[model samples]
Every structure is written in structure tokens, then in C-alpha cells.
Target chain A: MTAQIIPSRTAAEAALAEIFASAKAGLPGSGAVEKLREESFAAFARGGLPHRRIESWHYTDLRALMREALPIAPAPTRERRAALRKAAAALPANSLVLVDGVFAAELSGKLPEGVKVTSLSAALAEDRPGILESLAAAWAEADDAIVSLNAALMRDGVVIDVAPGASLAAPLHIVYASVAEKPAARFSRSLVKVGAGACLRLNEMSLGAGGRAGQTNNALIVDVGEGAEVGHTLSLTDTRPGSLRLETFLVRVAARAKFDSFALVTGGGLMRRQIFKLFAGPDAKGTLRGVSLLRGREHADTTLFVRHAATGCEGRQAFRYILDEESTGVFQGKVVVEPGAQKTDGKMLAKAIMLSDAATMNSRPELEIFADDVICGHGATCGGLNADQLFYLETRGLPPPEAEALLLEAFANELIDDIGHADLVAAYRAEVAAWLAARARSETRSVA
Target chain B: MLEIKNLNVAIGGRRILNDLDLKVAAGEVAAIMGPNGSGKSTLAYVIAGKEDYEVLSGEVLLDGENVLELSPDERAAKGLFLAFQYPVEIPGVATMTFLKAALNAQRKQRGEEELSIPEFMKRVKKAGDMLDIKPEMLRRALNVGFSGGEKKRMDIMQMALLEPRFAILDETDSGLDIDAVRIVADGVNALRSRQRGFLVITHYPRLLEHIVPDTVHVMAGGRIVRSGGKELASELERTGYREYAEEAA
Candidate 1:
């Protein structure tokens, strides 16, 4: 008999095994859903965690970054709920609040007319019509290990459905607040559907309390109906140093539909936000824009994949990163035009500004076109601030730090000003200013 | 008052300015006319505290204060300004905002309160009108996509807003037409006061017709080879720098 060799399991794998062994019996769903959970976990087990060997995850090796998985978060208590409500109160009115990955109906304000919102767990328990179908649609196209793990362990989220031809009078806000007393993890998934000819504005924010280390895995799936208009924005900030966050967004745009997405990441120790957008019908338009401000030892990665599947579709992706101290930022964007997708127009750009010698940025922008008549291009640049520009601002009477902050703000304002909403632009600007202030304070302290 | 005594500057290990000596008293305007490679722009940049040039010897004094140890912004706070020959185009930063920030920063360094938004608007509007700068131009990015005349007008507007005690105009008339040059010269003439001084560096003496200088110096081989009164500008305009160039050689 030939000798057999076995590879040792990593810490993440060992933690996954333990979680699966203890939580399998109590997990939700049956039949197809149960089978899906089992199959997804099995797939994750077979592959372990993504490392440098995976081309898509070359810059962010999760297996090495995430040493061990924290235990699943416990149910939210009265005190935690109170704290969450306080935090939610500071956000815009008519917002949905999720505490510890569970939807809090009491905390959520009144909903708009012609809109329906329900808890994902309650829908799963009642076997709600179209719930399984909607979840299965995204599952069919997902091939990522982190997304697979989220599918296997998702506990609860919110389900939103907008009536056909209806236009929302006000924007909808979703606040995800993590209030864990100990080191823990929470997984949540949401589904949103905008009806044909309808208009919807959705905003999301993720906040974590300070202190202990915590992990959050959240996923969102959006379906834009024919001729529908959807505007979505996400803000992830105020994350603690020990926090680990992974957020994934999957969007499908139909014929003549328009979808715009903007995400701002300013905090978090380790984070990876991915967006997969599919242009399913002709004449569709989609845009993805983001800004990341990282300092300290924080590591943030944004990966985007936009596929043009129909003729005459257009897509654009732009992202900027400002890294300081020992932080690292990564941007990987790919635009693919399938065969027969004639007249497809796509462009992608990634730019980074490194403020310190120890700061690092990895940018990869790729374009793959299988069609002859398509126009697709991508470009990436990473460098420090321009010396001439800096000197110009300095001669205008600005100190070094102030000049740098102004340049950084101008760099990011290119995208923020394009948001077209006054309140949203103001909010984003305030966040950028706060980040710059903190950076200046830290620099002063170090110098002292 | 601004003074450069026995100044020697080297850039990239190559001597650019050799034993240059000049002085401009308060309320006086000095013109430096020279050929293409005479380092007129180098003198302007070195005075503004640009980092590229190395001062081998001598000192640059502003009101008896050695400015070599200060940064560019510090020099600005000490009332020194340079109107770039080719004004930089900074996208996404509105001209009005840049003006406000610059004004406030200078005020802050001098231990003064920041200007209110309305006050700032009033000041900019007054200066903008004098320089024929439209409101739309102020709303757009600073010098981005601006015409050559418009950029020089914007520079004059900045000079008016800051009201620096000492200003250096480096090739300020390089790209402007006759009408644009008149408007720019008028703007500069409006800001000229007994407490302020100016160093007007130009390739041609045509601009001197509007903002005539009190003294004219011919620069060649990196030094001021000849010094004369305002009549020298007209003389140099007609005769060129051939005589001074040969004398320096």
C-alpha cells in the first residue's frame, strides 16, 4: 500500500469544524434550504479559507489574516437593545435597525407606503412564498468561500419589497449595529427587490461598539426591475481595532434599468467589501463608486466584478484609497463583456494615495472582452501627493498637514459630489473631515 | 523691503544664480529683464521659498528677517507672494474656496480671527469685479480649463485678496493679449501701495507701459550685469540684452 499524506487544518478550519459540529442541529430551514446549508458548509470545509494561492484573494489572504473564528453571537439582551436604539436614533428618520444580526421591529420606525419589510428569519420559519426563490437566485451565481460561509451561517436579516410603479417619498436607511458583550461573530443576509418603473433610495450603515474583538459577515442581494431606478449608499465607520467585517453586495439590473451604488469605508481593522453586478438586459446602466480611508494597522480591500451580458449596456467603476501609518489598502476590479454583447461600454479606475513610508496599496484593474465591438478599458495608479500641488497650496498659506488634508478631500470629493444628493454629500464630507482630523491628531502625538 | 545680498544658488549641482545682489525698498517696484536662460523665474521661486534650489551663500531678508529658514507657507504668512507664470490647475477645489482658505490661514498665522462667510464673499466679490472675474469663474475649479488670460486674472485676484507686502510677478505677461494685459496691469496697479513692494520679472518691456517700475536691472550669466532707471526698460526693449550678455561673458 502507498503511504498517504494529509494536510494539517488551519485555525480557521478547526474553528469552522467546531461551529458546525455544535450548531448543525439548531440551524434554520429544511429540505432545499437545509441541503444548501450543508452543501455550502461542505464546500467551505473542502477548500478551507482563501489564501494567497487564490488569485482573487492574493492581496488579502483570509486564512492567514483570520487566525481563529469567534463564537457565534448570542441573542440581544434588553440592555443591548436599548443601546442599539440610542445609536439608531442618531441616524436619519424612518430607519431599519438590526441588532446583533437580528431585525428589531420595535426599533425600526414607520415604513413608507407601498413598501413591505419583514424579518428574514420569520419568513424562513413560515416558508414565505418567494423567499426561497429569491435566496436561491443569488446562491446560483455565488462562487466565493466567504459568501459561502455566510450562506451556511446566516441567522437573520431584513426583506424589502417595493410595489410596482411606486416612487418612494423618502429614502430608506438600514442601520446594522453590533453590540456584543464578548468576542463573537454574526452572519446576516438581506434581499431587496425594486418593482418595474419604480424608484427607490436605500442607504446602509454598519457600526460596532468599542472594546472586545467582534466579527460581522453581512450580504445583500438586490434586484432591479425593468426601467426601475435605484440609488444605494453604504457607510462603514467607527469600527474597533479588533473588529473583522466582510460585506458582499450582488446586484442584477434588467432592461433599461439604472442602478447607482456608492460605499465609503473609513474604519475597521480588517475588512473586505465586494460587489458583483450583472447587466442582464440591454440598455441597462450601472455605476459603482467608493472611497476608503485607512490608518493605523487597518487593512481594507474592495473587489468589484461587473459583467456585461446584454448588448448596449454601460458600466463604470471608480474607487480611491487614502492610506496612512502602517495601513494597507487593496482594490481589484474587473469588467467583462460576454460574447454577442455588442456596443458594451465599460470603464474602471482605481487610485491610491500613500501618506507614510509603511503604508501600502495594491491596485489591479482588468478588462476582459470576448466581444469584438465592445469598448472596455481599465487603469490604476498609486502614488503620494504631488509635490508641485503641495507647494502651491503651501504658498497659499496652508500648513503641510492642512494642505495634505485639502488635497485628499479634493481627491475624494470627485466622487462624493457626483452623488447628486445634498444630504448624502454633506454626510460623506463630514466623515472625511473627521478622519483627517484624527490623522492629524495622531501625527501630532507621534511627533511630540 | 526685500533684499538679496551676494546670493548664490545651485540647482541639480549646476550653478544657476551667481553672486546676484539686488534690493527693493518699500513702495518701490523693481523690474528684472533678461534673456531666455537668465534665471528670472529661478529668482522668483527662490524668493517664494521653493525647495528645489540650494542657496550656496548669502541671505534673503524680508524686513530684516532671514527667510531661508522658513517654509513656503511661512514665507506667505510673512507677506511674500509669487504669481506663477503658468498657474497650476487644481481640479475639484473651487476658486472661491481656495481664496477663503488662503485668506483665513494667513490671518490665523498672524493671530487674527477667521473671516465670516459673508465677509469673505464680500471681499472676493469686490476683488473679482475689479479684475473682471465672473461669478461662474469663481465657482469653477481653480484655474482648471481656464483661458490664459483668465488664469492671469485669477492670479491678480489672489494677489489682491492676500494683499502681500512683497509680490513677485514671474512672466506675468507671457501669454496675455493686449486687452488682457491691460486688465491684469490695472489690477496690479490697484493693489500698489506705499507699504508694499513689487519685483516684476518679464522678458519684454511692453508690460512696463502700464505698471512702470522705478528701477530696471539687466540679468545675464546669473548676475545683475547692469542697473538703470525706468528709461532702461524702453532702452532694453529697443536694443535687447546683447550688450549686457557679452559684458557678463
Candidate 2:
């Protein structure tokens, strides 16, 4: 028999292994949760970092891009905490703040009636009902190594609960902030549970302190109860170079429930946002929209998977990307209609605009319909801005730059309007405007 | 106000305008009547500084400045306008937004302050009313889902708002009903002034009946083959362009 051979581990894998070994005891969990973490870590170890060989990760080679995993970030200093608190105070009422993946109770604001918020660590220690099961549910999928890793290294986050029949007056804001002065990493997980007949609006915003090139892996789980209406928005803006982030959203829509999620990503070294949604009960409706604006050498990937396990469900996914300079964008969406899920209507579309020759966009939309009476379709289109549209605007006295900006803004803002919250829509538009403004400045400087 | 001297333009090495020379002086409304493939639209586009065609050798002067070197927007600021035969449908951009942007951009390029909301609204309301445009239509995306008549009326409204020193209406009457043609013509007549010149490019003499031209030119194979008084338009409508097409060949 020949001698056994073992390939050497990648730098990131080795660093992750070391970090897990040293920090295992300090991780927030009890016996059952600890076992679940061990099992997840074991699964991750068996698979290693996702690579092009993995069908879902065809466009992103995380093992190669994540060269070395940085150490975990430490607790914030008093000054930094105070600064973050002041910043959080200025956000909308009923806000929750997290610093370096850990919940900052002092930074958060008061919650409204019929709503409760608790730190994920406390929930895990107290063995909250269904919390452990929720964390492990996603592991059943074969290509969930990233989610498994997040589970193993998860530190702290928040668990929000909305009471039954309660209608929230204001949206709940969750701000994920990183104030690390040096390269580090953070793993956080949050859950939102909307009870039956309740209505809730949630906003997730991630802010990275300037000059900090850190890595973040956060998971958000949303469970929409029967007849619940939930609107969720995630806006991620981090311009720091060398920063890498991976955010996973797991959403479940129950009977007659309506779930809408919008994600906006701009500026960051390397980013991957993957959403997994399931129609768990009949007559549930789900809508997912994502917009990514990338420039410079930034790279952003948005992947979506929707599983229709219940009959008479409707699902729609629309994504848009605007790439400039040498930036790259990728969109991968897959919709699966289970064998018994008849009368299911699902559609997925991804459209991208490449501004420069050096820029690149990859889109893949797939539909797997096992039911005979279901209507399911997928489409993807990638191209540069329309020449005729640009010329039309220019002929109306708008310069080339101004014309381009207007078209680009319109392209991105069209989806922002679908968020349904007037204030949030305005905020998202301002963010898009700011990104365009920055791009204009860079273009002018290059021309000069 | 606008002069084209020996303007030879080609697209992809195929000549569209062959040594074409035409001039429109201030206070003059010149009409160009031609058959299909006569390059009437090409002449209008070239004057508007569209980049699709290659100018082999020519000079397009607006107010004594060679507009060939200026961009399309710059040409617009220099008081040049072209109402396209087919107005582009731009989704996601409201008609009012496009109008406001165009008006402010032109003003800024001319080093003039932008109009306030009330003033801008007043101008839009006045021009839109003349074209029979509904306020709801202005709230929709520019030219998107608009009928042919509505599109033509929108272009005429834009012309009224811009008040260009010289305007070229390229086949503006095509695809329009008789009622639309009359409405569009009336809108153009309201903008007519001694200081502003107009070039009405069309095949039929129906539009000229409303906005009578001072000079009428017949074009064939890119160049103007005949020029005469307003009666020239009526003559072409009766005699047809078969002779001019053969003459150019």
C-alpha cells in the first residue's frame, strides 16, 4: 500500500483552525449549543473554504481570495464604545447596536411595546426554545460550509421578537459596526421572529470604521409567522480596502404571510451576500430585491436560493448591479419548486450594467420545477449602458457625465422604491446619490 | 443663424450627405421636402452634433461658431435643437425630470442661474397646455408607453420651452394623425419669432399649411436640388419627388 497523503491547509483555513481551538472555551453557548458548534465546525473542516469546484461558488473562489484569516476583534475601548453609542443614538428609535460582533446594550435605544430584544449569548445560555434548532437547520444543505463556519465561531448578536397581532409604528434598526483599528474578524448571528397576524419593518445597516480592513461573517434568520407582514432591508457600505464580508440571510415564510427583503451593497474589498428563503406554508408570498454598486477593485457577489415547499406560493427575485473600473459583480439565483408544491408561481431576474471594459459581471439564474402545474422562469442580462438612452439625454443639453449619472441613479433607485417605507426609500436614494457623487469626483480627478 | 457649407457626412464609409450646402437665416422658416432615403434626417442629426456620422469635410456654424467641435449639449447651449422623428423612450426617468434637467443644464452652460420651482412650473404648464399635454402624462416616464401623437406633442412642448434660436423638425408629422399634426403645428407657430429660425423637414405639405415656411428646398441623394418660395412646397406636393430623385442620380 502507498503512504497516505494529505494536502496542506490554506493560510486562512489554518488560521481559522487555530482561532477556533484557542477561542472554543470562550464562545457563548451551553452543552447542547456547544455540541452543535462542534458538529458545524467538523462539517466545515471536512469541506474547507468554498471554491470554484463548488457549483454554488463557481464565480467566487473564497479559498483563494480569503488569503489569511485575521484574529478575532477585541472588545471596544471606552472611548470607542461611547462614540458608537452616540452614533447609535442618532439612528431611528428602537435601535440595536453591535460592535465587533458583540451586542452593545448601552448603545441601543428603547424598544416599543409588544416587542422584546435579547442578546444572542443570553438566549444560547438559557437554551431558548427553537434557537439552537434554527442555527442548525441550515446545516442540512450540502453547500453550507460558510454558514457552518459562522455557527462555529459565532460570538454575539441580538434576538428580536414581535408579539402576535402587534403592528409596529416604527421600523426596528439593527446597526452592525466595526471599530477595529487593525485587521480582524467578527462572526455574529441574529434572529427575528414575527408572530402571527403581526406587522414589522426591520432595517439592517453595516458600517465599517474608515481605514479598518476587517472581515465580517454575520447570519440573520427571519421567521414570518402566519398572516404576518414583514419588510426587511439590509444596506452594507464599507469602502475600506482588504475588507472582506460574508452575510447570509435565512428567511422562512409561513401560511398567508408576506415577506419582502431588499439588500443594497456598495464599496468593500470583497463581499458575498447569500440569501436562502423557504415557503413553509401555503399561500405565502415572498419578494427579494438586491442592488450592488461596485467601483475600483471592489468585488460583490449576491446569491439567492428559494425553495417552494408549500403549495400555492408566489416568489419573486429581482437583482441589479452597476460595476465600474476593474470591479467585478456576480449574481446567482436558483428557484426550486418541490414536487407537491403545485400552483407555485416563481420568477427570478438579474440585470447588470458594466461601465468599463475592465469591469466584469457574471449572472446565473436557474429554475428547477418539479411540479406540473407550477409557473417558474428565470432570466439574466448583462451589458453596458444603452447608447441610445445616453445620446437622447445628451441631446437634451445634459453633458455626458450628467446623463450617465442620471441613468445610473434611475437604474439603482427603481428597486429602492420597492422597499415600501417612504423614509427608508429616501435614505437608500441618498446613499445611491452619495455613491454616484463619489464616482463623479473620481472621474473628474482622473480626467484632470 | 445656422449655416451648413459643403457638409459631406458618411456612416460606416457610406456617404449619407454628399457636399450638402444649406443655410437658414434669422427670421426665416425654411422647409426641406424630400423623398425616402434623401438624407433629410441625416442633415438634421449632423446639425445637432450627433456622433454617429463621420463628417468628411464640412462646417456647421451656429452663431458664427463651428459647432462640429462642440458636443451635442454644447450645441444645444448654442441655441440648436432637433426634434427627432422617433423620440427615445427612457424608462425610469420622468418627463418632468428630463425637462427640468435639460432646462437647468442649458441655463448652467450659458452661465445663467437656474429657475426656481414656481417659475419652472409656470413655464412647463404654459407649454404643456398649448400641446394639450395632460399633467399626468408629464408624471410618467419620458416617452415611455406614449402614443405617436403624444410623443410628437411632447417634442413640440420641449421646443416651446427651450426656445432655441434655430430648430430642426425632422419628420415631425410622420406617424401623427391629422389632429396631432394640427396641434403640433399650432404649438410650433406660437414659438415663431423674428429672432428664431425654423427648419421643417417633412414629406407632406400638410404641416406647412399651419406653419407656412418662407423658403422651401427639395433634397435628393443628400443635396438640395431645388429651392423656391413657399409655393415650392405646394408644387412638390403636387408634382412628387420622382424627378428630384432621378435628377440627383
User: Largest DockQ belongs to which candidate?
Assistant: 1
**Model 2 vs truth, CA RMSD:** 1.8
Query: For residues B16-52, what per-residue lDDT tens digits would candidate 1 score against the true structure?
Result: 8999999999999999999988888999999998899
Candidate 2 residue spans exceeding 4 A from truth: A1-6, A141-143, A209-211
The Cα local distance difference test for each model comes to 0.88, 0.90
Model 2 C-alpha lDDT per residue in residues A114-221, reported as the tens digit of each score: 899999999998999998877766555324888989999999999999999999989999888888777789999998889999999999986554327888999998
Clashing pairs in 1: none
- Candidate 1 docks with a DockQ of 0.79
Model 1 stretches astray by more than 4 angstroms: A1-6, A209-212, B247-249
lDDT: worst 10-residue window of model 2 chain B: B88-97
Tens-digit per-residue lDDT, A173-252, candidate 1: 88887787888888889889999999998989865543256888899999999999999989987677878889989999
Interface RMSD values, listed in order for every candidate: 0.7, 0.9
- Native-to-model Cα distance after best TM-score fit, residue A412 in candidate 1, in Å: 1.9
Worst 10 residues of 1 chain B by lDDT: B240-249
lDDT of 1 at A46: 76
lDDT leader: 2
Error of 1 at A111 (Å): 1.2
